[model samples]
Target: MQKIVDTAKGLEGLKRQWGVHAAGVILSRDPLVDVLPIHKREQDGAIITQWDMGACESIGLLKMDFLGLRNLTILDDCLDAIRENRGEDVVLEQLPLDDKPTYELLARGDTLGVFQFDGGPMRALLRSMIPDNFEDISAVGALYRPGPMGANAHNEYADRKNNRKPVVPIHPELAESLADILGDTYGLIVYQEQVMAIAQKVAGYTLGKADLLRRAMGKKKKEILDKEFQPFSAGMKEQGYTDAAIKTLWDILVPFSDYAFNKAHSAAYGVVSYWTAYLKANYPAEYMSGLLTSVGDDKDKSAVYLAECRRMGIKVLPPDVNESMARFAAVGQDIRFGLAAVRNVGTNVVEAIRRCRKEKGAYTDFYDFLRKVDAVACNKKTIESLIKAGAFDSMGHPRKGLLAIHADAIDSFLDIKRNEAVGQYDLFGDAFGGGDDAVGAGMVVTPQIPAGEWDKGDLLTFEREMLGLYVSDHPLFGVEHVLTAAADMTIGALAEESSVGDGAVVTLAGILSGVQRRITKQGRAWASATLEDLGGAVEVLFFPNTYEIVGQYIAEDAIVVVKGRVDRRDDQPRLMAMDMSLPDITAADEVKPVVLALPRPGARRRWSSGCARC
Candidate 1:
C-alpha cells in the first residue's frame, strides 16, 4: 500500500498522457511550440499541446470553447423546409423583437420543439415567467442552469418580470449606469457579462479590466480579487461614488458572479429559441418535419415529436413510396414519415428511390414502379419493407394487396422488360434490336387487390414494425388525458426523470408493446412487458406473484397503467410492477387489487429481477 501510494503520488498532477478537450481550444500569436509544449495527438494525429487549457490561458493565450448544437442543424432544416413549402424567405433579422404570438406560445409552455426552453424545468419556468418580450426570453436562457435555476433564481426572475415583485436597484447612486442594462432582469446579475457591464458602469472599470474582474470573481481567487478591488474601488471614488455605495455594489457582485452566465451565449441561444417558437407558431408542419427528421433514428424521440405533431393538428402519414423521401418532409400541411426511418430500409435504397422520384415524377402505381426502377436496388425485401411501412398505400390498394402482388407482380413486370430486351423478335430481322418502341409499350395489367381491408391492429403493427413507432395511430391516442391522470407520469416524462434513485415509486401509462414470459429459479412464471404510449416506452417487470395477480391485464395493444418502484439496475430505468390497471377504470375495480411488493420499512429484501426496456 505504501509503494502504490508513492507511485500514485508521482503520477498525480503530472501530464502522464495527452487527451483532446472536446470544447477547449488554445490560441496564441506566436508559434505554439515557442509558447507551450506541443505535440501530435496520437489518436487523430492533430497538432496539440501538452499544457492544459488553463495553463495556456495563464501564459497570455486565448482559449475559446465552441458549443456543439444539434438544434442549429434542426433550425437550418426547418428554415429550408419553410422556404420550400411557403415560397418566402423568412428573414430572421426582420422578425419583430416583441412578437406577441411568439411570446404567447412560449408563455403557454408549448415548447416541445423549441430550442433551449423545451426541457421540463425550463417549460415550468416559462409558464411562471410568462415572458412578454425578447429580454425575458434571453434572461430565461441565462437562468435555466444548474446554478441559477437550482438557487431558485427563476422564481425571483418570474416575480420581477411579472410585476409580482418590484425591480430593486443594486445601488441608488449607480442606478443610471445599471438601469438600461439590468432593468429587464430585475437587477439580478443573471449573466457573467452583466458583472463586467456592472463593473464598468458602477465601479468605473474599463471594459478589458472589468472582464478580468469578472474572471477573478468567477475563479474566486483572493490575490486576483484583491488586485481587482483596488482599481474598482478607486475608479468608483474617482467617479464621485461614496465608499458605502461601492461596498454595497461589490458585495452583490461576489456571490452572483459564480453562477452568472455569459450574456452573448445566452442571447444567441435565446434567438434560437425564438426562431423555433416562430417556426412552430406559423409553419408547424415544416418545423415538426425537421424535428422528426432530427430524431428519426431514435424511436423514443420520434414518438415524442410525432405526438407533439398530432397535438399541433398536423397529420403524420406513414412512409409512402410515391411521396416519402430520404428524410421527413411536409406535404402541404401533413408530415410524411421518411423512408429512411423504416426498419430494414437501407440508406442506399432510400437514395435510389428518392433519386428516381426526382428524375421522373412519383411512381406510376406499383408495377410501373417495379418495371422502371433498378430491380437489384429495390428488391423483393425492399418492396416488402415498403409494403409493411404502408408506402404502397397510394397505389390504390391496401398494404396486404401490395404484399400479395410483389411475389408475382415484380416478376411479370420484369418479364415484360426482359422480353422487350429482345425487341419482340419473332424470327424476323426487323425485330432484332432492343427498341424504345417495345419498351414503352411494355405494360402489365394491374393485379386484383384483396377485397378485405387489413385489420387496424395488423396495419398499425406493420407500421410500428417498420417505423419503430405507430404512424397512423397509437393504441392510447385519445385516452392520453385519462392515462395521464391515472398514471403518476407519462412514459416520456419518466424517461426524462429516469435518473431518480432506484426503488423510487412511479406510475406510468402506455400500451403493452411487447410481453415476454419466463420461468424463475423457483419454477414460478413471470412476465416482462413493454408499456408504451404516445410519450415513450418503458419496461415493466411482473414477478410471479404480481403476474399471477394481474396476468390478464397484461396484453399487447391494451392501454394499462403501470404502478411500480423504479428499478434502475440497468443503464436504462425500468418499472418493477406492483400494480397494473386499465385506463378509465378505478384501481378497486381491477380484477385483483394492486399488491405491490414494496420493501418493508425494517426489511432489506428486494422484489424483482432486472428488466430490459423495449
Candidate 2:
C-alpha cells in the first residue's frame, strides 16, 4: 500500500507530461530566455515554462497563480439570475457563515451544486459528521481526499471533532504551543503550516529554516533527515524537553509530511464549499439553473444534476418556444430547459427564435412563428428537432402534429417571404397585424392539430432521441417503481458498468427497443434487443436457448424484467439473458422468494442463475 501511494504521488509531477502550472505567470527583470527555457502551452498557445513552478521557484524567480474557478462562475450566474427574476442583488460572499439553514442543508447531504463537497463519499461524511459550523465544513474538504484519507482518519477526526473522542497530544508539555493551531483539528497534523509552526516552537528553529525543515520532511530523504535531526533534538533539549518527548512528536511529523495539506489553500476551498452550500440552501432555483447550464452538453451529468434539482423540489420544465432562452433559465421558482440541449438544434436557430420572441411578444402559434422567423435558420431539420424536444408543446400542438407539418410550415412561410420581396402586399393596409388586408392576396394558414397525445413509446422515444434523455416520461414509467425495487441492477448500471464485473449475473427492468432476431448458422434462433430505462440503456442478447423460451417477450416497446450475465467480452459490454418475464407487480411475494442473493453487497446487487425475474 505504501509503495502504491508513493507510485501514485510520483505521477503528480509528470501527470501534465512535462507541463507548467495552469495559471503560473513568471515575471523576470531580465529577458525570459536568459532565465529559463520556455514554450507555448499546447492547449491554449500561452507562453509557459518548460519546468514546473517548484523548479522555477528554486531558481530564484517569482511565480503567480491565477486560477479560474467554476464555482465562482456558477455563483455569479446564480446572482445575476436572482437580480433578473426577483429584482434582488443577492450578495452571497457577504452572507454570514453562521447561517443555520446552510448548515442544516449540509447535514442532509443535499450539496449537488456545491463545490468540493458533492462527491458520494463526501456526502456520506457530511451526513455522519453533521457539520454545525464553518470550520467543520472546511475540515471535511481538506480531509476527504485520497492522500489524506486512510486508517480511520475520517472517523478519528469526526469523532474528536464532535467530542466523541478525546483530544490528545504527543506530549503534555507540547499542548500549550500546539493548542491554538490544532485545537480545532483534534490535535491531528492536517496542514503544512502546522508542521512549520510546530518545528519553530518545539525545536527553537527560525521560521525560514523551519520551512526548509518542512521541505526535507516532505521529501523523506534519509540523508537530509540524518543531517537535520541532530539540530532538531539539540534545540528541543535546550528548551528543556526530554529525548522521549522529541521522538514522540517527531514520529508523527514523519508520516504527516507526506500529504499534509497547505492550511491557506484548504481554508480557501473550504469557504467556497460552504458558500456553495449556502447558495443551494437559499436560492435553489437560481443555483440549479446555472448548474444545469454548466453541464448541459453532457447527458449523464445532466441527468444526475436534474435529479438533484427534483430532490430540491425545483421543477424542470421542457423547453418552450414561447418562453425558453438560449440556456437554462429560472422561471419564477422553476428552471426552464434550454434549447441548446436539443440535439441538432443549431445556435443560429436558437438566436433567431430568441430575437423574434423578444421583438414580437410571445409566439401566438406555430404558423405565426414560421411566418416571421428566419427561414434560413428555421429549416426542416431544425423544426423537426424543436418539435421532438417539445419546444412547440406550449403552442397547443402535440409534437407529432408539429413534426408532421414542419416542412409544410417552412414551405408556406418561404413562399410568402418571396412574394413580399416581389411587392405583393396591399399598399392601402397597415404594415403589421391588419388581418387579411395586410397582404393583397395572401392568407395566414394555421396547421390542423389533433386533440390527443402521441403514443407513449413514440413520445418518449422522440424526447430521448432529440433531448439526450426522457423528459416527459420514461418508457418504463408504469412498472419501473416496482421493478427497480425488485431487480438486481438497473439498465443504467449495466450500461455504465459503474461497479459491476464482467460475466456477472444481473437483473434489470427496461422498455425493449431495436429488436433484431435471426436464425443461427446451425438453424437455431437468436435475438438482440436494446433495453433502456431513464438513467441509461444496455443491449440484452438472447442465445438460442433463452430466445426460444422468451421469444414472445422480445419485441420493441415491450417492458420486461430479465436476469442475465453481463458479457464484458465485447468492446461495449452487453447482457446475456439467463431468465426473463414480463413485469408483474402482484408477483413480488413469489419472485422475492426465488431471487438468489449473490455475493455482491449493499444497494447494488449482482445476480446468478438462481436469481429470479420480477
Candidate 3:
C-alpha cells in the first residue's frame, strides 16, 4: 500500500516537458518538479501559463480569470440619480423584472442611458421590436447579436410581439425548459440557460456534466466533445428521443451556442439598461444632468448629449459662476452646463469657484467675485477659454466684450480686493455712505458691455461651447433657406438622402464639431472633421483646408458653416467640404452684429432667457 501511494505521488510530481517523466520518477533538477507547462511565444517575449480549469487539472496548477467591469459605474450613477430625485433608493435586485416603463422605453428606442443595448442598431431594433416585458428584453438582448445576421433577431422579436408568427418549440421536453423564456419572445432559444436545460432534459445528463458540456460547446473543443457526445446521445436515445428530432434540436443549438451568450451576463446588463431607460423616461432633467456631467471632457459626446437633450425639450443653460455649479446641475427640466468642461480651465478652478460661492452667497458682480477668489487661479488662457465657452454670459457681457477686457478687468479686480482687505478706504468713503461710495468707486474701473455689438458668430460659438450643442442660434441661420434650395436639404434632412453618386451639393450650416487628425502615406497631416447642425452630425474632409482658413476658430465648440457637396469616401456617406467659413457666411462678405428691438420690461427678460435656448 505504501509503495503504491509513493508511486502515484511521484508520478503526479513530474514535470514532463523541461525534464523527464520516465518510470514515474520525474527525474529533474528539482525533486518537486514543476508539472505546469511554461508558455512561450516569440511575438511577446514571455512565458504565459496556460492554467485555465482544464489546463490546471491536467498540469497540476490553478487558474482564475479576474474581470473588471464598467457596468458597476453605470449602476452607481443610476441609483444615485434615483435616490436624489425620488427619495426612493432602488435596489435593482428587488425591482420587478416585468417593468412596464422599462419595456415602453425599449419599445421607443430611447435606450440612450441603457447599458449594453444603447447602440444605434439596438436603438433601431428597440423602436421596431417593441418589447413588452423583461423576458423580451433579456431575449432581445441575447438574440440581437451577430449570429442573427442582418437584424434577424430584431425582426424575429418584432414579428413575434405583433402576433405575426406563432411560437414553436423544438421538442416536447423543451416545452417546460423554454416556457419561462417564451413569455417575451414566445419560446425563442435566446439564452444559455435554455441550452443547459435542453442538454439536461433531452440528454439525461446531470447538471454538472451538462455545464461541462456547455463550456466545451462554448469553447468549441473537439476532443472533450468527442469524449462527451456518446453518453449524451445514448442517454437521449434511452429517453426515447428519435435521432432525427435530436439532430434537429442539436443543429439549431450548436450554431447559437457557437455564439451562445451567457444569460447571467445579459440579465446583469439589463438592470443598467432598464435604469437608463427609466431615467430617460421619468427624469429627463436629472438624467441629462448626469449624462452631461459624465461626458463633460468629451466634447463630441457632450455635443451629442446636448442634441438629445434639446430633442427631449430639455434646456441646457450656459455656465455662470454665480448660477451654475462646477458639474452639470438640474434647473427644472434644463441642464446647466458644467464649468469644468471648458477647455484650458482646470477642474480645480471650477471647484474653487463653487467653493467660493458656497462659503459666501451668490456673487454680487465681477468685483464682488474677484474679492473672494484669486484671479491668477484662472490664467489668461483659462479666462479666454471660459470666455469662449460663455462662462460669463450671465454677467451681462457679450463673450467678445468679456474677452476684450479680460486682462484689465483681472488687474483692476485684484487691486481693489487687495486694497479692501487692508482697510485702505478711498477719500470719499463715508460721503455717500460707505457701501454706496465703494460701489461707485468700483464701478469706474469695472468692465462694461457695449450697447449694440453682439456678433452672430461669437454668439453661436459661445452658446455652442457652453450648451455643448448649437443653441441661441445655428451658424447658418440665414443660409438655411439657401441650403434648403441648393442641396434640397436642411440639417434634419441629411439622414434621408441616399449614399449614391457624388451625393448631394449640401449647403448645410452647423457649429464646427471637431477635427480629427491623421497622417497620410506621404507623411502629411490631413483631417476628417465633424460639423453639427440642429438636425444631426455630418462628417467633413479637410486635406489642406486647415491651413488656409483660421485655425483659431477650431477651438472647442466654434460655430462654422461648411458649404461643400456631399460624397461618400469610404462606404460611409460624408460631406466633402470645398469651402468652410465662420458665422459671417453672408454674400455681402462682411461681419455684422445683431440688432434687437426692445420688448416690454417683463417680455425683455423672458425673450433673453428664451434666446438662450434658441
Count of backbone clashes for each model?
1, 1, 2
Candidate 3 stretches greater than 4 Å from native? 1-99, 148-154, 171-185, 221-230, 376-378, 416-444, 462-472, 476-528, 534-539, 542-614
**What are the Cα lDDT values of the candidates?**
0.77, 0.77, 0.64
Q: Cα RMSD to native, each candidate?
A: 9.9, 9.0, 12.4
**What is the C-alpha lDDT profile of model 2 across 1-614, one tens digit per residue?**
99999998988766556645667788788998999999877688988777778888888898887899988888888888888778998776688999988988887776766898766666777876778887787677767754457535676787777677898876887888789878878887777888888888888899998999888987888898888889999999999888888998887777677776787888899888887888788888988999888887767567767766765678888998888888888999999988888888888888888887787667777876776566555578888888888888887887877777778767766666666667675454466555332422246465676567789778888887888777766655445567777587655445553458897888888778779999989999999987776555678889999988989878888878888988888767788998898876665444443444323121134343335553
Model 1 residue runs over 4 Å out of place are: 1-9, 12-18, 41-43, 169-181, 197-210, 220-252, 355-361, 414-447, 498-503, 518-527, 543-548, 567-573, 584-614
Q: Cα deviation of 501 in candidate 3 (Å)?
A: 17
- Model 2 residue 237 lDDT? 93
TM-score of each: 0.82, 0.79, 0.69
* Candidate number of the best TM-score: 1
User: Which segments of model 2 are wrong by more than 4 Å?
Assistant: 1-20, 40-44, 52-54, 171-177, 237-245, 421-447, 476-484, 487-614
**Residue-wise C-alpha lDDT for candidate 3, range 322-373, written one tens digit per residue:** 8676677777667677677666667778877888778867766555665556
Candidate 3, residue 406: CA error in Å?
A: 2.8
Writing each residue's lDDT as its tens digit, candidate 1 over 80-152 gives 8888877878777777777777877787788987998777767777888888788888888888775675557
